[model samples]
Target chain A: TQLLEQSPQFLSIQEGENLTVYCNSSSVFSSLQWYRQEPGEGPVLLVTVVTGGEVKKLKRLTFQFGDARKDSSLHITAAQPGDTGLYLCATVPFNKFYFGSGTKLNVKP
Target chain B: DAGITQSPRHKVTETGTPVTLRCHQTENHRYMYWYRQDPGHGLRLIHYSYGVKDTDKGEVSDGYSVSRSKTEDFLLTLESATSSQTSVYFCAISETGGSYEQYFGPGTRLTVT
Candidate 1:
């Protein structure tokens, strides 16, 4: 079985603070996706990285895929209170996806 | 709001009781999935359907069953509810191809006491 490990299960920082969360696995993945979920709601897809060493940015959020395709990271700059939520990384091998535990972020104002 | 919705947004049941959750989507996607979210476990898939009557087990399929009889509807049932099965259930939909990037529905919070 494939396992994805996520770091910093809990994060709390004041607004404007920058932080990074990581997802790592020993097994290679064809694609990886980032999702953010709020309380009482299902996760929302943020980005998908398919190519190795690929980096994609959305607003203040940046996502990086490792060259080995076994790890990924999400960096947020100038974090705001709106950024508080649970962040999850999912690896897609063929058709199904296996997800990392998750990182919970609290951006306090 | 990916056009997916789960019925009985919140439910409370007792152990050994039978419970069913309903998922409906208007997107008509070919792939549908059911997942459960726990405190530190992220989201674990319980079952997924590739097409009507073409369902398959996921990583965590024990004690649960699912069916997709129509393109727009999928159902998840628990034969005997346990406290361990108490979690938030989410339904996801994706098109047939690509990375199958999924869109999730508002979750159903089930409590087994």
Candidate 2:
């Protein structure tokens, strides 16, 4: 089974701070997706990285896929209260999919 | 929103009781999935359906069953509810051909006491 391990299970920081979350795996993945879920709601897809060593940015969020396709990272800059949520990483391998444990981020005002 | 909706936003049931959750989508997606979310476990796949009547077990499928009789509706059934089964369930949809992008539903919170 392919497993994705996430670090810093929980994080709390003040507004305007920067933080990075990681997702690592021993198996290569065809694609990786990042999602942010708010309380009482389903997760919203933030980005998808398909190629090894790929990097994508969305506003204050940046996502990077390792060259081995077995790891990924999410960096948030100038965090705000709106950025507080549970961030999840999911990897797709053929017909199977695996999700990381998740990182709960709390951005204080 | 993914045009997906899950019925019974919250349910409380006793152990051994049978329960079924319903998922409906307006996107006509060919792939539908069921997942459970726990405090430390972000989300674990319970089951997934590629097409009508074509379903497969996921990482955590024990004691649970699912069916997709129509393109828009997928149903997840718990043969016997257990305390361990108490968690938030989510339904997701994706197009065929391995786009790998899944759109998620609001979610259902089930409590087995």
Candidate 3:
């Protein structure tokens, strides 16, 4: 079983459209992080939400941590072609970092 | 920007052969990790090191072994390569165990035939 579950395994939308990806789990975590991975490169940290119900905004991207700390969401406003990549949510439980299957986003021009 | 690099960005090895991938970091972070990314599996941990000569097994460490003789270098060795082991391996570093942001290396793509 996957420690984290992400929804909409793949998403393709036209530029300027808005979309949201989700990450959920049955267990509570101290914190959760969101990363974006481009082709042929490693994933890069986008934002980290430590407290429950915390929301962070990074430019056109917004991340929200669930009140129960078992889920999180990433919403993109006015998506652009440059936002095309794999979106992964991660957390550290039991001293090990676990990642979700990831949501592959394709923002078409 | 993480000052981390993986050796032999890409490698192809035959079955039953031993293969070692090296991860070198200039950040001198205390914790280092090795993870393998597959099609449906985002990134599964293989092994991790907390300090020099201090290491522990990850979720998927059955066929892999890690050595961290120094703080700046961590090595992952596959005893006998298997076709199932073909995946892209990534190295990440963090200052602390959890809650801290991790910096990742470019990654090494290994193909076992």
Candidate 4:
């Protein structure tokens, strides 16, 4: 069983479209992080949410941490080809890192 | 750049052979990690180090062992390779104690036949 569960294991949409990826868990975390990874490379941090009910926006991307700190969501606005990659959610529990079963996003031009 | 690198970016080895993957960082981070990424499994932590000679097991510690004798180097070893161990291994580092601002390396593609 996975500690973090992500929805829409895979997503493919055309440019200019909008979409949302979610990560859910029963346990609470002190902080949640989002990362984007391209093929043949490692994941790059996109954002980190530390507070409950916190919402952070990075240009066209929006991130929200659940009020209970047990879930997170990533929203992409006007998606583009450059946004195509694997999006993963991570958290630290018991001094260890746990990652969600990522959502692979493909934005076609 | 986080200044991380993994040796033998791609390797193919037969079963029963011993294999070791090296992870080196130049940032002199205090925390290092070893993880394996596989389809449907996401990124599972195999081992991590807090400081020199201080290491701990992660969720997937079986069949793998890690050593951290120096601040900049973390090594993962497989006593006897098996086909089930084939996957992409990633090395990550963080300067903070809580895994803050963690960064990953290019990864090592291991093929155990």
For each candidate in turn, the TM-score is 0.97, 0.97, 0.99, 0.99
In candidate 1, what are the lDDT values of residues A1-109, reduced to their tens digit?
4389999999999999999999999888888999999988889899999999999999999999999999999999999999999999997655776788899999999
Clashing residue pairs in all predictions, respectively, total 0, 0, 0, 0
Best by DockQ: 3
Quote the lDDT for B87 in model 3: 99
For model 4 the local lDDT of residue A47 reads 95
Write one digit per residue (lDDT tens) for candidate 2, span B43-82. Answer: 9999999999999889999999999989999999999999
The regions of model 4 sitting more than 4 angstroms off are: none
In angstroms, give how far residue A42 of model 2 lies from its true place.
0.4
In order, what DockQ does each candidate have? 0.72, 0.72, 0.87, 0.79
TM-score of 3: 0.99
Better of 2 and 3 by DockQ: 3
Tens-place lDDT digits, model 2, residues A9-89: 999999999999999988888889999999999988899999999999999999999999999999999999999999999
lDDT of 3 by residue, A8-108 (tens): 99999999999999999999999999999999999999999999999999999999999999999999999999999999999998779999999999999
Q: Which stretches of candidate 1 lie over 4 Å from their true place?
A: none
Q: Candidate 4: TM-score? A: 0.99
- List clashing residue pairs in candidate 4: none
Per-residue lDDT for B48-100 in model 1, tens only? 99999998888899999998889999999999999999999999999873476
Off by over 4 Å in 3: none
CAPRI rating of model 3: high
